[model samples]
Target: MKKWVLAFIAAMTFSIAAHAAIEVYEFDTLQQEEQFKELGHTLRCPKCQNNTIADSNAELAQDLRHKVYEMTKEGKSKNEIVEYMIDRYGNFVTYNPPFTLATSILWLGPLAVVVLGFGLIVVRSRKNKQVATEEKWDPEKEQRLKALLDEKNDGDKQ
Candidate 1:
């Protein structure tokens, strides 16, 4: 395993030094390279956050890069390409997924939690306010306790 890893690293070093091959396709032009790069950076790796598929050195990103390159060469509309990738990989492919009933919860869940937390605080505050207002002691019970204390005091004085 160590030997294989070393060999892979050596190959990667060699590849890194090698230039990126610009495939000369009749349909694809160099003009579309900037557009492709922009689209690539917008896409997310399903496994990672903040790391664009273009920036990630993962094998999955390479496959996706190939797909994006082909789609761009084919002159498919940007929307169509984005839709295709989303269909293939789900909403996980996008840095931000579209808002719909299914996705609405994902987008709003945190806000909903904050609102609920606020509500709980308000309810707890009202309860606390009410707690100090109510008289808990029965007057009869108070009088009985006071009489017992006076009787004990009288015995102690004797």
Candidate 2:
């Protein structure tokens, strides 16, 4: 039947469309595999936001993955490879940056924000707790209110 043929075709199409990604290399090369893993985690995907190239599915990620495979196979020192990438692409291409006087503010910015937020909340809560609610009514007005309420109650009874 046409229904059965269409169903089979649809299932095949869906399966084919799924990304069949897998690890490109076996674990037998212990030194190379470990280094690649570390390098992969360090390298940023040029086309993906904040994700390492190895963890991204972008075209640039694939190219970087190939680059890692080739570079590691050629026995380049890990530091040398990182320095090369940093030199070619600048610091933004990698997640980690060196610690210096200029970067001290960048590193401490989140902690400063949290401390400021907590201080603001404490100050606001103190302000809220300081609300004045007690009121002093004039003695003459209180007496007038009592007289009016008593008269209303007497009228309702009558």
Candidate 3:
């Protein structure tokens, strides 16, 4: 059993060593390389909605990465590349989407909810305080309640 475990560990080490090298892309200038990397981090993967293209391993993300590299090589501006992606995949492709009529809800919905939550809390707290302070036990009512309880107890005993 120990021998098998050692062999498995050795196999894993070799496999990891075989694939340890990071991928490097050739660029005419360091600025273009930096731009390509920045775009990869900025662009959201359509297939993996929560992950950027740089982090996602999905096939679509790979294609998008290649496309971004191609566009960068073609001397396309950052805005042009972003606009192309937005045109193809809609605003969901970018983390910072423009504030259009359609996207206003995305920006304002949380604010509305927060305001509503605070208003509700205030109303509830005020109501609770008013109930606590305004409540007064009447002696007559107390006497009547005690009498009713005693009558019920007597009836139960009987």
Find the candidate with the highest lDDT and give its number.
3
lDDT (tens digit, per residue) of candidate 3 on 62-156: 89999999999999989999999999999999999999999999999999999999999999999999999898889998999999877756546
Give me the displacement of residue 34 in model 3, in angstroms: 1.2
Model 3 scores a C-alpha lDDT of 0.93
**In what order do the candidates fall by TM-score, top score first?**
3, 1, 2
lDDT of 1: 0.82
Error of 3 at 15 (Å): 7.2
- Enumerate residue pairs that collide in model 2: none
Worst 10 residues of 1 by lDDT: 19-28
Please rank every candidate by lDDT, starting with the best.
Answer: 3, 1, 2
C-alpha local distance difference test of each model: 0.82, 0.81, 0.93
Q: Which residue pairs overlap in candidate 1's backbone?
A: none
Clashes of 3: 0
What TM-score, to 2 decimals, does candidate 3 have? Answer: 0.71
**Model 3, C-alpha of 85: deviation from truth (Å):** 0.6
